[model samples]
Target: MAMRKLKHKQVPVWIRLRHLPVELWTVKGLSTVASGIGRPLYPDAITRACTRLDFAHVCVMLDVSSKLPKHIIIMMPKEEGGEITCKIDVEYEWLPPKCTSCMTLGHMAKVCAFTKPSNPAIPPVSVLFLKRYLQGHHPCSRLKGWTNRERDELPHGKTKREYRRLKGWTTSERDESISCRPKRRTTKERDESVLVKEG
Candidate 1:
């Protein structure tokens, strides 16, 4: 027996396309060129004929529906073909949010009843290490392979000094100001300076 494949139904999303050329406002003009950017919503997608829902007073609103999340459609006018360049805005402000917890649409994680109970929050040990590291409290020995001058030159805070003392690492009287460190000249600057001298 040949198994028939199940076709998944596409959800129609409402989107507003803005800044379309005034000429392309008609169903025929929009339908002809719209597919090049994104699939039109339906009910005369190809002909792009405005459905009862898409029509406005004195204007025919083209159906701009797609199964895709987002699109940046480019269109060519019938008269000009590929000569003129233009951009159209496709807004999906009415699209519902897909919930992560429940694997359903229209709600967020905060309101989803399917969300798992979270464990009690505990303070992380890495936070202390990171705070110390950012405060110029890293071990001097970690500066290995760097110049002895740079190693001796790096600064640590008073709190860092206390921590370093506790760790039995050498504490120095030298400046521990991380931001005040002199900027090293790069090769580009050196080359530019040499070129300026030659010029």
Candidate 2:
């Protein structure tokens, strides 16, 4: 037999119904409440046994395109004649990421292949490149701004003696052979300088 791949957009997710009325604890009531969200499958063992009163767990088949509501209003028949309204909160246990670009499941719309990036001017960074950059394994030359340590470690065509001599010299001199950028001062240093100027 030839194997065939099946793509299903509708998925069964376990949802919790909170603040349910006492009259709606039965199978029919649970089904009626869950129907508002999706196709109700069945309640959990605990829900059926009524062991836990916190919430009722039910498996609901939800479509990827369907709107996931946070709360649903239910109309309960009063003892006299008119029906009373009650609000029940719906909590999904787990839901797969859906892509709105292609109307498919598994991936989000932001990272979808069919969807174009909002800004084409800036290129997206790869996971491996970001990981290596974070780990300090990648070269800092490609980056726009460089830290003091990175600047110090950068290759300059100067001799060891000349490099050591230039290291101690803090003069603000910019030469073609040597790149001399002023060191960034901390907030405390800036505050001290401000006080000295004020005095």
Candidate 3:
């Protein structure tokens, strides 16, 4: 028998595109252009229509049953009076969490307070030192890092905050296991309301 080659099946772009329409790195450009700034069109059906119709207005509409973006859709509208009207989309970059130290994100460690002018590398020993100084029972007392200067500088003063943490010792404080119990007495004689005649 003649040697036969095992053929690998090729998935069409249409099938693959149905799963992931764009690659990860491609989003930023898509976001800028999609927001209406001009750029190169994503090679899709809309481009061919614009080429044929030569219509000044063209848009790359989306079928959102898959709901990639729940609320917004990108539209390419014609400029009222401009030479270049072709539009593109750049994907948005999601803003990252703010650094309490440096107050910005997208980058950390490089620009953070722990490495900046006032701050230096936070050693584990610095935290143990703060725990010794603060005299706090807070879980954060065990946290590692230099204490925020404001926290370390608080004036020695009596605060309602201190008393709130301690249990009250008065008998009224005991209510002695009371919320679970019924206020009414339980005995049969007590269950019946008592009346006294004034002579």
In model 2, where do residues sit more than 4 Å from their true spots? 1-7, 116-199
The candidate scoring highest on lDDT is: 2
Q: lDDT for each of the candidates?
A: 0.45, 0.74, 0.33
lDDT digits (tens) for residues 33-150 of candidate 1: 4454345544235225444333211212222232443444554545646556666655553545655555556667787655745674777678766755643544453444332223
Mind giving the per-residue lDDT tens digits that candidate 3 earns over 22-110?
A: 22114443334333322223434543343322212222333212222312233433458534333222332232333444443434555
Model 3 local distance difference test score = 0.33
The alpha-carbon lDDT assigned to residue 175 of candidate 1 equals 62
The best candidate in terms of TM-score: 2
**Residue by residue across 1-199, what tens digits does model 2's lDDT show?**
9996455689999999999998899999999999999999999999999999899999999988879999999989999999999999999999898888787888888887668766679676698766545434333222444333232332333322211112222342453132345467667665554211111
Error of 1 at 68 (Å): 6.7
User: What are the TM-scores, per candidate, against the unseen true structure?
Assistant: 0.33, 0.56, 0.15
